[model samples]
Target chain A: MTRPDPESRRNPPGAHLGAGGSAYAFLFFPMAILTVFVLAPTIIGLGLSFFEWKGGPLWTGAGGWNLPTFVGLQHYRSLLSDPDIRHGLINTIAFVVGSVPISVLVAFVLAVAVNSPWFRGKALVRTLLFMPTIVSIVAVGFVWRWVLNDSAGILNWFLSLLGYNDPPNWLADGYWPLFWIVVVQIWRQIGFCLVLYLAALQAVSPSLYEAAAIDGATRLGSVRHITWPMVAPMTAFLMVTGVISALQVFDLVFIMTGENETRYTTVLNLEIFREFSYGSFGYAAAIGVLIFVITIAATALQLAAFGTRHPKAAGRAAK
Target chain B: MSREHRRRAANTFNRPPFAVRLASHIVVYTVAATMLIPFLWMVLTSLKTSGEANTPPSLSNLLPATPQWSNYATAWNVGGHVSLLDFYINSFMVAAITTVLAVAHNALAGFAFSKMRFRGKAPLFWATLLTMMLPAQVFFIFAYVLCSWIGYIDNIQALVVPFLASGFGVFYMRQAVTAVPDDLIDAGRVDGMHSFDIFWTIVRPIVWPGITALAIFTFMNSWNSFFWPLLVVDSMKMKTLPLAVADLASAAYFTDYPTTMAAATLLVLPLVILFFFMQRAFTQGIAMTGLKE
Candidate 1:
């Protein structure tokens, strides 16, 4: 496969799909879509972070356009001091900190459970578990809002049934709002993590377990020593991807939390949407830039941290 | 099953003790029930009257006194500016067109990337990978700016055109295409098939599962999309199902829990139903792609 094809050298880009103009034809639409929609806008967003533009045409004769003016580092400087952005940063962090470990841990356990030899109805249980991950987050968030309504919600009703007369308002009472938001986020995400972990566990070579068994290891010890190490790559992948998605969580927090309650649950993406709505285009772009940076940094930090313990897993995670 | 699949199945060890297996059953089933309760709640609430739905939970309140099957119809006409039917139609059209076009484009590009030799392929593929990691919000903000500048806001094209291709789709389809043997393509070339013809007849049939996965994903993303639609869709007529459902919560109908719940049910039911029929393709696709948004 590595040898260069001499026929192609004579035939000008070969006669397969790589035949000169036809290859470019195959690429044209995807390239144009990526360039115009994804690439150009990404560059424009990065450039817009350094300038103040109220989201309009670049230049015009009669001031109809909101021309961008160079603001240097002012947007970034203000983001450091802005309370809302700070709260958003904190909430975003709180979500990442709260959701990733809990979901990954729960998913790991469930994956182990379902992958066990004695597990029954495996396909049905997996299908039901994975159902939530596929549904619309916005719709589910609305359902959760109904379920968590302070007065008449089913959750508080269930809590009352559990012997607490005064259960905290799941949607509005201070930290409980973010708590439930994080919980729902975990609920929605666990299935995804579960599926990935299941795949990883299924891929583990049974010979490793047999070797551990020959070494006189107990089941628990074998799990800790063999199963855990085998799935480390998937764990790293889940954590990295989980953090990136959790950072941009918008639908749940937006729909579940009330208008004034955004202080507790507003994520960075919500802040971006809010700021964009308020005509602070540059600031919104700056927040997006912040998310982009944090996503990269968090991924790198995870890969590095995982590298120390599981270098092979860390290498795969980087890909 | 394939030999590889059989080997993996053989990896399972002996059954645990009765107590251990029972405990695993309880834990797994309990978590599964917890996952499903909200969906059950959504469907049940949609069938209840406002009075019943508004009250605290009880065994009686759990089931509607008389199922208000017309709540779906009520939610349909409750959209002040546009009916729920319009939203469904809009969402359906946008998702359908976007999925069809995106799958085609992604397959073509994936085949080229995996099999074809061309100039600048390395850099272009790298650029595609770079965009895969970028947060959609970054591109979205500038996309909003660009759309407004080009007067694409409130236009359905804004919804369909931008999403007609994605880096993940192309990258995923590339992986699928990479799994096909080179001998197959060479055989086609030796048979005097044109490049596009070979791609259409040979490469496409081989990578259909990958295409189905990409199509389902693209459709779900487009159908459930809220953020981009929120930004670009100004008029009520252009609102998709998700946007319409979200609006129901903020609209005057917010207190009408049954109707709102019904609308939310309408929004969620299609994908769930589609998923049920296409379960294997959906799950296998995710495992194959090894990533999700």
Candidate 2:
């Protein structure tokens, strides 16, 4: 047998570059834009967290806002004590903790059911499930708002017909506002998660199921022993992304709950918007930092818990 | 047993039982119907007259006695200070331009990371990936301040500029580009093609599917973006489709459900149409974003 070329083994053909300048040339534009837009703002946000800037711009010229005063964690300290911020933090956490697991589980089940060979019209089902994800959140908010409206809403009307005189006012009552918001969030999100789960499910080998079936394992037993473990990485991916977006929940709250209902609907992003609108820029930046911290910590915790293996890695290894 | 009988028995065991199939189909259709109810209601209500839409507690009110085709016209022309046409134009322009710029920038960066050799490439790539994990709200306040300082506040550029370089886009493109065969790049290099030339001529065509996926994702995201547009655009003339639809929904103290539904139906119609035509691409793009290789 002929041996493989050691030179080819050591250095892949495309791995070699004639000069370093070409690499920098390709990278310069994106790096510059990201640095300016994403990186600089992040660093500036962190710096802004320590300073107090009222009025308008930070300049001292005519028509300029007051100079930024160095407050050195004062904003952070006050945020810890602010009732509204505290409430906002709790609401944000509740939204994440409440929605992520439920959506993931629902998505997983749907994916499994759809992936079964006997399941018919799978494409149509997948499209219908994913329809909400493509629509604007604002549209979703409007549609659901009408659907859940107390007096003239379809849900309440259906409830009344069922012999209940009054159904709980979904968007108006205490706790129900948050409840409906989470429902809407999950509703929009399930499609995305379902598609992901389906992809992961498709990648799951059917041979494993055939083997399990030959061993006299029931469908539930096979799914429990094989499907659940196989889709763990996708679950982690969903969990981290879900928590990050949930922590930054704003559009649903803004459109669903509307203004002056912050007591029930305020999340950290809404709190930031409220503060920014009130010209509390520094305080808003502080809240922004807090959100950043919470997202990072939550993501880190998820990664630690689930291990950072890509689902596709398993597919590749199987091949 | 004989060979034919054994084969038939194996087939019987392979297929699910009739009861199981019935149960699964029942659950699946119910879930699909539940998922579709809001969309059905939105379309139904858009055809409803204002009175019918606001009518209290009646199954008859669910569908209009006569379709209110006028609601669409009214929603287009007189619903808000800026008509739905202007909002469509604004949304299209912003989303289109942002998609173009983001794709170009991310593709370039992806090409470099995937095909080139350079010092500090790993760190630079990791840095970009790190930003993906941070929520946009974390940097958006300072971004707002930056926009104001740059005189972009209340301007369309405010909606477009901050999104021109997306970390997710860069990461996605890098993954796609890395999967391109190295032999192709070498052949292009042997033909004396510059790296950019190779990227343009060879790599891009090879990775066109990835680019299409990214484009769909970016376009949908930009079109549906609400928070940044809401924060930056205070004027009536500058609102995107989402901001405009939201404004219409909240206008008139939320009394005009039909017109609001009309506005919403218009806003979502294009995407739904696009999704139907490109269901495979849409689902693939979504799944690609979620489960990175």
Query: Considering every candidate listed, which one attains the maximal DockQ?
Result: 1
Q: What is the lDDT of candidate 2?
A: 0.82
lDDT, residue B133, model 2: 65
- The reply for model 1, stretches above 4 Å from the true place, is A1-16, A64-66, A259-261, A311-319, B1-13, B252-254
* Per-residue lDDT value at A160 in model 1: 83
Q: Which digits, one per residue and each the tens of the lDDT, describe model 2 over residues A132-228?
A: 8888888988899889987778788777878887678788878898998888888878888989998898777566665666778777866767788
DockQ of 2: 0.56
Query: Which pairs clash in model 1?
Result: none
For model 1, what is the C-alpha lDDT against the true structure? Answer: 0.84
C-alpha positional error of residue B89 in candidate 1 after TM-score superposition, expressed in Å: 0.5
Question: What lDDT tens digits, residue by residue, belong to model 1 across residues B168-235?
Answer: 98899899988888768887787888888888998899999989988999998898887789889988
TM-score of chain A of 2: 0.89
Cα RMSD for candidates in order: 3.2, 3.9
Displacement of the residue A72 alpha carbon in candidate 2, Å? 1.6
Q: List the residue pairs that clash in candidate 2.
A: none
